[model samples]
Target: MIVIPTRLKSTRFENKILCDIFGVPMFIATANVAKKVDDVLIAVDDEKVLKIANDYGFKAVMTKTTHESGTDRINEAVSKMGLKDSEVIINLQADEPFFEGLNLTKFKEFAMEQILNQDAFMASAYKYIEKSEADNPNLVKVVVDENSTALYFSRSKIPFDREPYNDYKGHIGIYAYSVKTLMEFCDFSQSKLEKTEKLEQLRALSNGKKISMLKMESKSIGIDTKEDLEKALKVFKKVNND
Candidate 1:
């Protein structure tokens, strides 16, 4: 199941999810696009968001307003829905409307393949980072071993080099895992690295949960700040015209 965990109190762009994109609410646009591949649900924190979601003709679930992270909200939604242990859950951000979802189709295959050989239960994707974005803390960086197993995820530039850096991978904000593993990860305490970097994925990595990383090409336009939203609007117009 594809789930979007959204809330109203956005730090950078207040109520960004409700902002219009392509003539509709950003979250609704995201869900409508995702529905082309499969059914989608929105886990929201407030009645306003829930009402908006339902008005958009999408399934909505109300979660605790006190949740620390979106993942925690997703975990609670999964439990509330009573999903099967083997059911796959994808957390696609409500603000990302252009994510190339074809890549996600392979997550189950890759995860199962890794499970047979390693301890991988969670999976995510990354893309090559631009030179300018390499030093940007807003874009998370990831370094992986030869096997494509994530070595670390950080807000700072990773794999610091003495010479000119050659390659950098920016972490995407989407994740895929079974309902069971999703809950397990939520129960784990925030790790030291997680606290320092403020990245929840580190909590799973710190607790010995293997996260398999997939290389992806297509990406979504993320709306974080007003400038980003403006860029997204232009992109939306271009996409619509195309």
Candidate 2:
């Protein structure tokens, strides 16, 4: 099952989830995309968001507004939905409405494979970061070991590029976790690196959790600032027309 954590408050773009995109709220567009998964729910804090979700006939639940991150919101929703401990929960962001169907399908496949191997508790998508985006702090970079397990996540350019870079990987916001791992993650307090870098995934890493990165052919645009929303709206319109 997939859970979308949406909130009305955003420092970069106020009420971004409620903003209109081709006549529908931006959050609805994201929900619509996520509903393509096998099972999904929208976890929201605002009553207005809940009403809008119900009006659109999507499965949604109201959660506490004090949740620190989307992961926390998803944990609450998973418990409310009465999902099994072994159930796979994909954490899809409300700001990302352009996720490709094939990528999602592939992600599920890889997650199942990892579970079968008894190797990983969580998985996320990673894309080859373009040179242009390498220096962008907003585009978080990740380094992986030889086995492809994540070593560290950094906001600055990784590998230093001292001898010129050949390849780089950027973390995508999407994540999949087993209910057991999700509960454990929520129980763990924020770590030093997590607070310093402001990256929630780092908390797991700090605790020696292995996060498998599934390299995908496609990437989704997450709406952060007004410009990002504009670009995402254009992409959404094109996708809707198709």
Candidate 3:
């Protein structure tokens, strides 16, 4: 199941999930893309969000207003919904409207393989990005081992490019984990690296947990700031016109 954790307010863009994108709210657009891959659920934090989700004919569950992260929010929603421990849950960010259906399909397959092989309890994807683009803090950078297992994720540029390199691996905003692992991850104390980098995936890595990384091409735009939304809008228009 694909679960979108929807928080009403954001530090950078307030009520961003409700922001209009391509004639629909951003969260709704994200759900539409997710629906193409699997069952979609919106784990919302506000009554306004819940009402909007219902009006749009989407399944939603209310979570706590004070949850620190989307991961925590979805954990509550999944627990309330009584999902089985073995069920895989994809945690797609509500702000990532352009996370394509094809990428999600590939992500699901990769996640299943990782889970079955016991390679990692957590899974995510990354794509090769230009070194120049990697300088943008909003576009997170990830380094992986020979097996495509993630070593570290950071908002700052990684590896320092001791030698000139053309590309870096940029982390995508989506994640997959079984209900059991999700619950266990949330139980872990918020790690120093996680708090410092503001990247939740670090908590798992800091706790000596493995996160399998899938390398794939994706056109998803994660709308963190208003500037990101503007960029996405331009890309959206261009894609449609083409």
lDDT per residue as tens, model 1, 93-112? 88887676575556545655
Candidate order by lDDT, highest to lowest? Answer: 3, 2, 1
Estimate, for each residue in 162-183, the C-alpha lDDT of model 2 and write its tens digit: 7978688988888888888999
* Sliding window of 10 residues with minimal summed lDDT for model 2: 112-121
| Residue-level lDDT tens digits of model 3 in 128-190 | 998789889988999999999899999999978899976699999889999999999999989
Comparing 1 with 2 on TM-score, the higher-scoring candidate is 2
Ranking by TM-score: 3, 2, 1
Whole-structure CA lDDT of model 2 = 0.84
Query: For each candidate, what is the lDDT?
Result: 0.83, 0.84, 0.92
TM-score, one value per model? 0.93, 0.94, 0.98
Model 1: CA > 4 A from native: 106-119
**Among all windows of ten consecutive residues in candidate 1, which has the lowest summed lDDT?**
109-118
RMSD of each: 1.9, 1.7, 0.9
lDDT of 3: 0.92
Number of backbone collisions per candidate, in order? 0, 0, 0
Select the stronger candidate by TM-score from 2 and 3.
3
TM-score, candidate 2, is: 0.94
